[model samples]
Structures are given as C-alpha cells and as structure tokens.
Target: MSEAQNPNATLSVAILSGKGGVGKTNLALNLSYALFRAGHRILLMDFDVGLANVDVLLGLSPEKNLQDLFRPDVTAEEVVLAVEPGGFDFLPAASGVPEMLEMDDDMREVLFHKLNKVFGSYDYLMLDLGAGISQTILSVAAMSQLRVLVVTPEPTSLTDSYAVIKVLHTQYGITDFHIIVNQVEGPADTQATFTRLSTACNHFLGFEPILLGGVRSDPALPAAVRRQIPLLRHAPRSPAAQDIVNGAVKLHRVRQQRQQALVDAPVLGKIPIIRK
Candidate 1:
C-alpha cells in the first residue's frame, strides 16, 4: 500500500542485531521508555517470536500476545498490553511457538495490515526484532522506516553485524541504517566500534550507516534487568540510561529530518499550466 493510503503513518523502527547476547532487547525496551517519557505515544512490540521476552524484562504477565492476533476472531487491539504508570503499550510475542516464527505471504500481509490499524493511534512503533537474519526479521526490517542495528565491542559481534548488514543491503536493497554501539567502555570505544563497522560497510557495501550513539557499560543495567525493570526507570541517572536518552533524542531528530525531506520532495504526475 502507498504511504498515503496507510492509516498509520507512525514512524516504525525495527531494532535488530546480528547476534544474540548483545543487549539489543534491553536497549529497545529502555529506548521505548525514554521516548515515552519524552511525551511521545510509543508502542513496543516484541517481534522475537521464538524467544519473546519484552514482557519478561518488564516483569509483566500479559495474558494475550501476538499469537492471539493470528486467530480470525481476534484483533490486534485486544492483544496489546498497556503498561502502567507510563501508559505506553506493549505487544508481547508468543515464545516457544515455532509456528509464529515463520509466516507465509498471505499471513505476513494480514498481520502487517492488522498491525498498521492498531498502531495508527501511536506516534511511534518500536519493533524489537529477533537477532540475526531470519526471513521474518528481514521482512520487518524492510518494511520499517528506521532500522537500528545494535552491536557490541566484541569482534564476533562486529563480524556478525556486518554479515546481517551485507545481506540486507545486497539481498533486500536496504541501505539506510542507524548503528548503536552497546556495552562500551567510553567515548573512544564507542567511536572505535562504530568506525570499524562503518569503515567495513563503506568499503564493501558502499554505504556508511549513521552512528546513533552508544550505551556505556553500567552495573545498574544488570541490576535493573535482574529486577525486571527498565534501566531508565530503575536508574535514570546511570550512564547507560543517559546514553539511551541521548540516542532517543537523535532518533527523533532523524525522524523529523526524514519527514521534512519527504514533505520537500516534488510530487510527480502533476502538470504545470502557464498563467494568463
């Protein structure tokens, strides 16, 4: 469907990573919270069907999930869980449901159509996609307006991230990407990590991803995770939380710029007439 026909023009962002254990989900959750706190209506959907855990991290026990939406009688609005205190919405995915991981063309189209209807009410839809380059992940990433790739300081993480980027760029033709360096030591580490990845991408893929920012390593993050609370709310002053807030601000600015660019672009199929 064309962008104008879509009811929800909400900015959709897919948060993904090349490998697991890179704190991608945590970053997604905290970033959603940060955006919500900044007065934006946000919906965080745990699209990691196999190991869905956004609710687990938030200590929420959602009775319904994306699985319910698959039923013909159910609607996407009914499956969403409104998080308390902040009023942000969370869409939990079905964990350990192998069927949910793979989707046929028809199913994929129906699911996204329902999602667009439900997400139309929100200003932002943050999809926490599963790690790696699964078909589902690539599909969702291709549809999203903003694609944020999370990477760590580890060599394996960087390599895997490059692999995913290469596939998306070459196979899916998705060149625009925003890189987030997670679990960093300091500013130098963040810059080094981003530079290494961007340099490789530029040399090979011929595209350089924008560095969204970095989240520093902090003890508070683990403690918050253990407590099943978002680090932003658990320890707002922590370095990691601060980093997430900064990243959210950058994301908002990028979204605005893209919107402006679209508005400024000239429309086709219009005829100009000379004035009398």
Candidate 2:
C-alpha cells in the first residue's frame, strides 16, 4: 500500500486523560478544529465509544457512526462525516451502548481492520480517547504516534494523569507524552501544574513529559460547549481558544517531524495493535 493506503505518512494522535471532567474531549475537539483552521487535513475520531459525545459537542447528527462502521456493509468513509464550520472529517462513536463499551478482542480486530482502510487519508488522526486506562484505550494510546496527556491543576488530576503515564510507559515504553494543562490560570499556573507532573514522572518513571501548552480558564469555553459550537468557531479570540490555537501551532510542527520519521522508519503492523 502507498502512504495514502497505509500508516506511513498519517500521524495518529490520541488525546486522553486519566479521569473524567479534566476537559479531555473538549480540547480534542477544539485542537483538531484549530489544526483544521491551520490548513491540515484532520480526522477527529471520537474513541469514547459508549459515551461518545463529539457529535453532540459539534452539534452534528450523523446518520452513520462508529457502530455502523462495524457492520460489514458499512465503510469508514461511508460513516465519516465532514464537520461543518470547522471543515474536518469526523468519525463519531455510539453513546450509551453497553455492548460497545465492553468491546472484546475480536470486536477490536474488526474495528482496526475497518479503520486501517482510512488512516492514511488524513494528515493527522486526532483520537479523543476514553478517560482512564482500559485494555482498548491502552492499546490505542500505545500505538498512536503522539500520546497527548491532558491534565488540570488539581492534585487528583495530576495523580490520575501520572497513573496513566506510568501504565503506558511500563507496558509499552511510551515516553513521548505531550502534556497540555487545561483550564489554567496563567503561564505561571501552567508551569506549576506541569512541574508537579514532570517531577513525579522524572522521579519515578525516569522521564518527563513535554509541556505542549496550556489552555487558560475562560468562561467562553463552557459557553461554546453549551451552545454546541467549536471554541475556535465560537470565540477564536477567547483566552482558551487562543491557547488551543497556540498548541495547535506547536503540534503541527511536531507532527511534521514525526511524519517524516515514520516515513523513514519501519511500518507499523496491522492491528489489533499495541506495545509500540
């Protein structure tokens, strides 16, 4: 397969968290939007299968979702929708489906087979993964080229985020964690929060995660969410939105570096994938 049909060029980035209410999904959505605005072909996959809400956040009602992709007749291209106003491809997941939550290895193989067909088409595959460490999430995070750990300033948030980092590092030797401190007060607060997490990682894991950037606490962020609008689209000038846009700029450069490295390096194996 050429780069368009394989994983050689496309950069898969999974934005994840250790716990809920840390604004993982929201940042995933906006950062993808910001990158799209920055002239990249982005495909934002809502991997929070059972409780998926990317569609709800974007105010989209897709006729086909990730659930439909599992059906033999349904293709990822068929289910993937073009996000309006934001102008990126979106692969939405089913919400409140019990069986989708308890996905087995067989089901995952089916999903990987389906997704592999479309992975090569985008410049960046922004995966909004489910919170906490599950088998499926662990595998996905491990396989992704970039694992973005979104954390807040709270002690519990840092603790849980460290737990995630430790698990992924121990299991798969994933050391390139890009940390983004969301809802921060300012640069000082962001540094403080990152220092705390970095200290823990350096002391225990012998690695420190890169501080990508921080999203300051902005009321417009929640308002955008409430109104079902992308923060970039809603209030691009807002503090949180600007922070995300800045992060996207840094992310774009990193992605270009990684993509070239992937092309020059060996190809990733077919899924079910993990242990990178």
Candidate 3:
C-alpha cells in the first residue's frame, strides 16, 4: 500500500462548506459508503481536527485516533482505523490531539510523506473536513485534488460558500471547484440555489464552478445520523440515498475522464492528481 507500488493512486477529495450544519459530514459519510459499494477501495478521513464526529456517525468507537500518529514513536500504520463491512479504511481525528491548530514543519512533512506513501493504494481517499474556513481546515481543503462545496438554500449558506471560494482563489489559487446543493426542497429549489452561487462565483470570483449536482433534503438523514449508520444502508430506497448514489457516479465519471485525458494527451505536461 505504498506510493511507489500504487501508480494508479486514489483521487483525494475534501468535502468542505463555508458554515456548519449544512450536511457536510452527512455527505462525506454516505459518499464514502456509496463509493465503497461501487467497488472502489476508499478511505474516509475525519480531518475535523478539534471536533471530529465521523466515528459517531458511523457508530463505531475506536480506542485510537489520529493522536496516535502525533506521538513521539508511533508509526503511521498505528493510526489508521479500518471500518468493517465496507472495506474502506479511515484516519480518525478525535478530540484533544496536541498541536491540533497547526502541524509544525516537521510534523507536516511527516504527514505529507506518509499520505503520499500510502494514498496510491486506494481508488479514492475522501477527507471529511470540519465546517468553517479556519486556517488549518482551509489548508487541508486546498491540498486535495478535488473539492466538494456543499450548500443549502439559506442565505447564510450561500454567503459563506462565496467566502470559501474567495479564500480558495486568493489563498491557494485554485480554479477547479465543484458545487453540490444539499437540503433542497425540490429540483426547482436546487436550481435556484445553484444559480445564485454560480452567478456569484463567475461574476466575482472570476471562475466557473461546475455543478456536481444536489441532494434533496430528507428526514431520513438526521435519523440515520442518530443511529450511526450510512443512509444508503439505513434507507437505501430513500430519495436522498438515491441522490447520493447518483452524485457518486458523477464524481467517479469525472475522475475517470480526467485520468483518460491525461493518458491521451501527448504533452502530459503535469498531471494534477493532487493539488500539492
């Protein structure tokens, strides 16, 4: 599972939103399960730093979290938590890890190298980032090859999403961004929200944000979260579950097309597999 052996490395994507309580973690949790069901080796990373709850959502409690990796002598392998049944592994970020705000230069290098060394093993490494645009969280978001900006129909959500795109453009100089409208009442509502966000990004951010699609607001989401199970398994026939599957398919196709384009292009200048 080392980088050298994994030539067809997994595509790293971080799910981020400008504000909290917009179903960011819900999307990340179910999306990982959807990808796993689609037969890809997936790794769901809880990179929430101070307040990670991916474990609670999944209904599993591990004695070890990412804190183990930060210890003086623990190896990288010691921190990975394997989720049962789905075969998708995870790197959990629980509460009270020392230096949670920022990883020092040495720690950053070690983490980057460890990720590079192991990321090639899977087809997708999905990071569930914390809400808000903190320096640490935003840095992690920018590092990913792809980003999923989740938003609702709320005015605050739209405003915060704009702020996130602005930060990404100014701080990381990233132009490739995708939008996913969540918690919509219906297709019309989804369109309205998407249009507003897209117009703002194009007019002000100087970039066109592609619509990655939307997930209709479903009552089953919170219920599943309470039960600590993926919505796909808890309510497979639900509208939201089906939408998640559709989203996963779209995302998978996008990644495949990008890879194929890289392969077909004769120049092959620099493949942007991961941003960094």
Candidate 4:
C-alpha cells in the first residue's frame, strides 16, 4: 500500500503453498474480499490452471474462463468474471484443461501480456497460484511483486514450505517473502510453528521471512465453503473471518505506509515495493 503502489502501479501478490489442501484458496478469496471492502480495486486470478477452484469456492459457473483467453480471437476482458458489489474481478483458470499445467515459456509470456493489459485498471492483482512448486507455478511466483506462502502446523507442511523457499531462492534469487500460519490451534502453536520456520530459513536459507500472522481452525470456514460464499461475507463474526480481515488490514496498512515512504523519500534504500 506504499505510495509506489498508487494508481500508476498495481501491487500484485501471489498466494501460494508447497502443499495442497491447506486452505490457500480459502484465505486468498476472503483476503481479496477484505481488500475490496476496504475500497481497493482488485483483480483476482486463479492460477491453479487446470485444477482451478476459486470459481467453485464462490459457487460460480463462468461460461468463459482462462482457456477462452487462448482462443484465436478472444480478448482477456471477454473471459474475466466480475464479482459484483465488491469491486473485484477474476480471471478463472480452466478446470480439466491439462494443458494449463504444461504451458511453455511462449504461452506463459502470452498469458502475462494479456493479464498485464487487463490488470492496468485495478489497484491490486491477487493471484491464487496453484499448489506445488512446478515450473509454471514457480515462474508465476518469480514474476509476482509479493509472495504470501501459506502452511499448516504439520511437519510435512513445514517441509514443503521450506522446499518452496529453497526453490525460490535458488531459481529466482528472491529473499523478501511472507508466511501465514493457518489452522493454528492456539497462539502457542502458531508461535512454535513460526519459530520452526524462521529457524529453518535462517539456518538453511540464510534469510528471514516475515510472519504475517495466523488463522485459527474454525468450522465456519468449511461451512462457508459449503455455502459457496466467502467467510467474510457468510460468517463475518467467526474467528477465521476475523483473522483474515485483520490480516488484510495489516497488509493494507503496510502497503499504505510503504506508499507514503516512497512519496516522501523518493528512493528509500533498497526495500523493494511489491509491484509488477
């Protein structure tokens, strides 16, 4: 939300995780909704490619999807679905399209170009990246302005996050990253998990990741999923919903502060402002 992230430049963040089924999409949907509620124009992209589910999470059945963008005469605007009353639009990935997982560099370039054209009108572009660290997902991660890595409390989840971190460092040379601990039973559990991840990154990756905060395991999240609406809209008072709202506020505040700094200082050392 830094001044650098004004209407002239859109702040793009990719919500990702090394492991699947850790509520990556869930957090992304509500988080974007929270930002939208805060009056930011957001364009959410379902980068899950062939296994896209953001639309499903919203209980939407779009006639034209990401696949339609690849058609001979289709424009990116034609396939984007508008999530009304919230000021957020989305470009849903095509489910059951195997080719999405195997896009070449050329196709990837095309995708980014089209996305860039459509993204110009928005203030924030949030990408719900697919699970796992494949070439496609990694490429998207490397290209995005901010990367929000989600992981659970389990050891396997930690290991997978570490692996993804290793890949990002080795391949993209990216060091500025954020982590969100999801499904935490309590604060102590969240701290322990965060500490373990911090220690792993320090000892192994030679970098420190900012802890963006945690979300308690709440039944309302899944219930909202069942109802095909975001928890923020469906169960605003629930703990999970509250946590996401707070996180989005924090994110918004951070961006705003950064924006102010950029405006006042012109060039504030080397801290990179997340943008395309």
Candidate 5:
C-alpha cells in the first residue's frame, strides 16, 4: 500500500544527534510518552539499529525486531511492541547485531515500504536514530518529514552537531531543522547555547535551525533511566519531563502552522480566456 492511499496523515520525526551520551534516546522515549499523553496516537521506532536501547529503557524483552522483517513470513506489525501504561507502540531494533547495520538500497527501500504500510494509523511516528551521521542515519533522516538534532551544552557536542547539520544541508539539501538543547543548566544557558549554534549555522551553513527549546539537567531524569522507565512516567513533575511535554506541544503547533500555510497557498495554472 502507498502512503497516499492511507486516509490518515502521519507526521514522521527523526530524533538524531551528532554524538552519543547526549541523552538523545532518553528525550525520544519521554517525548513519545508526552505526545501520547496529549491524546495523539504515537509510534516510536528504535532506528538506532545495532545500538537499539528502547526495549532496555522500557524493560521489555521483545522476541521480534527489525531482523524479523528480513524473514519471508514476518510482517511489520509482528515486529512492533506496545509499551504498557504509556500505550504507545514501538518497533525495536536488534542491538550488537553486525548484519543489521548494513543495508543495501534494495533492503532499505523494502524496510521503508514496510514502515509506510504500517505507520498510516499513527498520528506521529518518532524515530530514535543512532548518534552520528552514517549511511543508515542519512537514509532515515531523508525519509522523515522533520529532523530534530538533539545537542547538549558541551563544546564537543556543539561542534559535532554543527558537522551533522552541515552534511545534511550541503549534501542532502535539508535546510529546515528543529533543534533541542538537552542537559542544560538553566534557561539562560539554553538560550545562550541556542544562540551560539544558530549564529554559527547562519554564518557558515547559511540556514538557521529552529529552536524547539531545551531540556534542563534534571536529576530525576537519570534516576528514572536507572529505574528502566520513561521520565514522564517515573517523575511526571520533574523539570526534564515537563520540558519534553512542552517541546511536544511546540512541535504540534509548528506542524499545524506548516499544514495551514500549505492549505492557504495559492494554486498555479494558466489563466482561462473568455469569449464574447
């Protein structure tokens, strides 16, 4: 089945980062829960491939993952695991599986088709991509409607994040990006970090990224992770969790505005002539 044939319109977001240990996956997991709480049907895909950890974070032991898609008899629906309590579904990836890391063009297309077929029912499909820019990462990023770059206050994180943006913009022609500065000290730090990054991008890459906001460095976040649960569920009142909720709301509003602009756009065609 094709995407156009599906009645529901799904907005796909890829949560990516330039380096690991920046809390990208954690944000993705919590943001998924946040969106679900807002009454949207969400699907989270652990597209981190060989380093997949969504199942570990959720304390789930799924029998199937992306590897199962390679099997002739298995379908995409069979590989999806639903997270209890949060009620959002996720397609887990196999960790440390060397073979799963490499996919040719044919395999990639097949996987894309499978996901497209099963994702129509979802209002939002969030892909928790692995850190760094790779062939696999680029493929998924290109496929997604929104690419969110998760970064931190560290200098290395900022540099790496800029490199990823440069590659995507110069090579793939991806101009618009949504950025979330994670693990920050305060709003001042967040704004400062965003300003620096945006200024650099505008100066070098010629395109400024949209700041979706920042996630503060909350102790509750790490504690919740250690307990193998989403921050939103483990500590609903935590600052980090609240940040995710706020980010989700902002994302929805941005999407709505873009859709409205498209709807209100003028159509182009040749003017018809009238006869006397």
Candidate 6:
C-alpha cells in the first residue's frame, strides 16, 4: 500500500470504544474479515482482557490464549488461532482470566515481545481494545499507527466517546482519530451524529476527526451474533455486513494514504511498539 512498501511493514490499528456494549468487538472482527477477504493477511487480538469474548462470538474454545504465551512451553504462534469462515488469525484471551484482568507493566512488555515476532507475517493487525480510557488501553493505543473510535447515536455514548478523545489528545498527544457511527437507522441521522461529535472535537480538541462510515441498524446482525456466526459469514448480504465492508474499504484507503505519506516523509517511520 505504500510506495513499494517495506517488506516487514505491518500497519496496526486499534479498534476501541468509549463504553462497552456498543458492538466494538463485532465491528473489529467483521472488518478484519472484510480486509482479509480482500486478500490482506490480517491478525486480530482480543485485547479486552478479562472480558474477552471474540472467541465466544465465533464459538471457539481455544487451546491457548494470550495467557498461554507466558507459559514456558507455549510460544506466541502456538497461542494464535486460525479463525474459520473469516480466514484470519486471532489471538484470543478468554473471559474471567484473572491474570489478564490485572496485567502489570512487565506483563505488557512481555506480551508485546512474544507477539512481535509474528507481526511481520501479516499486513495488518487489529487490536480489539477494552472499552473506556484505561491506562492499559491508552498505552497500547498510543503505540498503534491509527485508532478508530466506534460510537452510537445514544447521548451517553457520545459523551463518553468525547471523554476518550479528550484524554487521548490531552494526555497522549493523539489528535488524529477515525470515527465509525454504528447502529445507524439512516444516513441523514448518522451524518447528524457524526457532525455533532466532530463539532465538539474540532471546537474543543482543535482537530476534526475523519468519518470512515456508518453501520446500519440491522436485526440480522444480532441474529447472526446470537447464532455464533459472523455477520459476513452468516448473512453476507445483510445491510450491516455491507456497511462493515464499506467501512473496511475506507479504512484500507486511509492506511494507503498514511503509507504513502511515510514514504515521502523520512521521519514518519513505523511507530515501534515492540522495542526491547
């Protein structure tokens, strides 16, 4: 995607939300599949830690997870699972894993180190981060090349999302953010929501976020989730599925633009998240 991109270049994006239950993980899972379908090697990490449920969403009971990577005999590759129907690699951390719930700073570094060897094997890596602005979320997010903020039309969702943007900007100096409006009933109202969020961001944070796309409110989405099938796999023609594909395309384009920019600007090297 870059101008004759570096062979080892792997663009990492953090998929996060301000609060839970906004379908952030669902978006992350499907969007990665869309890109993987388009022929890019994709890897998804269920970084929600204690509440990890990506494996559950796919009805997968993995033999190993992020926790297993810490085991002396378990390597990072062994902990990674090859997800079916999506054809992408997944790193799952099951729910109720107390160690994952309370990862110390050293654990974070070790986890990253264990996975860094495998990062170059993929074209993109999606970090399905936990909701809110926890230090665990922010530190890993700050290391990513881009962050896509998922939101809904609810008033509380908007407020909490703004709080996330504020903290990322003020604390970490992260100004660029892409937005995806989920659960949209129509384009007009969706645009209004994005406008409201963007206005607050531009006025207060001094930066306007980019709108990737909006996912329609579709019953089929929940139905597919309930059945433990991916939206694209269970209902490929569904409106929500199509919306996710569209958003993935837009996201791919943004990555391409950023890649080209890095080529032209020498100092814009890949942000190293796995430093020794």
Question: All candidates' TM-scores?
Answer: 0.91, 0.92, 0.89, 0.90, 0.90, 0.90
User: Once model 3 is optimally superposed onto the true structure by TM-score, how far is the C-alpha of residue 165 displaced, in angstroms?
Assistant: 0.5
For candidate 3, write residues 7-113 as lDDT tens digits: 46567788989899899988998988998898887888888886788888888787777666656676656777778554588778867564875665576556665
Go through the candidates in order and give the clash count of each: 0, 0, 0, 6, 0, 0
* CA RMSD of all predictions: 7.2, 2.9, 4.3, 4.6, 7.6, 3.9
Return the clash pairs for model 2, or none. none
In order, candidate lDDTs are 0.85, 0.85, 0.79, 0.81, 0.82, 0.83
lDDT tens string, model 5, 72-183? 7889989988785444888999888776676767877667667666776666788999988886786677667788999999999999999888877776777879999999
TM-score of 3: 0.89
Question: Model 2, 10-108: lDDT tens per residue?
Answer: 788889999999999999999998888877778899999757999999889888888887789988889888885444889988887778776777887
- Where model 4 places Cα greater than 4 Å from the true spot, the runs are 1-7, 260-276
lDDT of 1 by residue, 1-276 (tens): 544333344677889999999999999999999989987778899999989999989999888888888788888888888885554889999999887787666777667667766776666789999999887787778777789999999999999999989988877677889999999999999999999999999999898999999999999999999999999989999999999999999998886777655343321111122123
* Candidate 4 lDDT, 1-276, residue by residue in tens: 542244445667789998998999999999999989888888888989857999999989888887777776888988888996556888888877787887887787666666666675676788999888887788778777678999999999999999998888877788878888999987788889989998999998899898888999999998999999999999999998888988898877666655543333311022223333
lDDT value, candidate 1, whole model: 0.85
lDDT of 6: 0.83
Candidate 5 lDDT trough over 10 residues, lowest sum? 266-275
**Model 6 superposed RMSD (Cα):** 3.9
Judged by TM-score relative to the true structure, which candidate is superior, 2 or 6?
Answer: 2
Q: Give the number of the best model, judged by TM-score.
A: 2
For model 1, state the Cα shift of residue 70 in Å: 1.1
Clashes of 6: 0
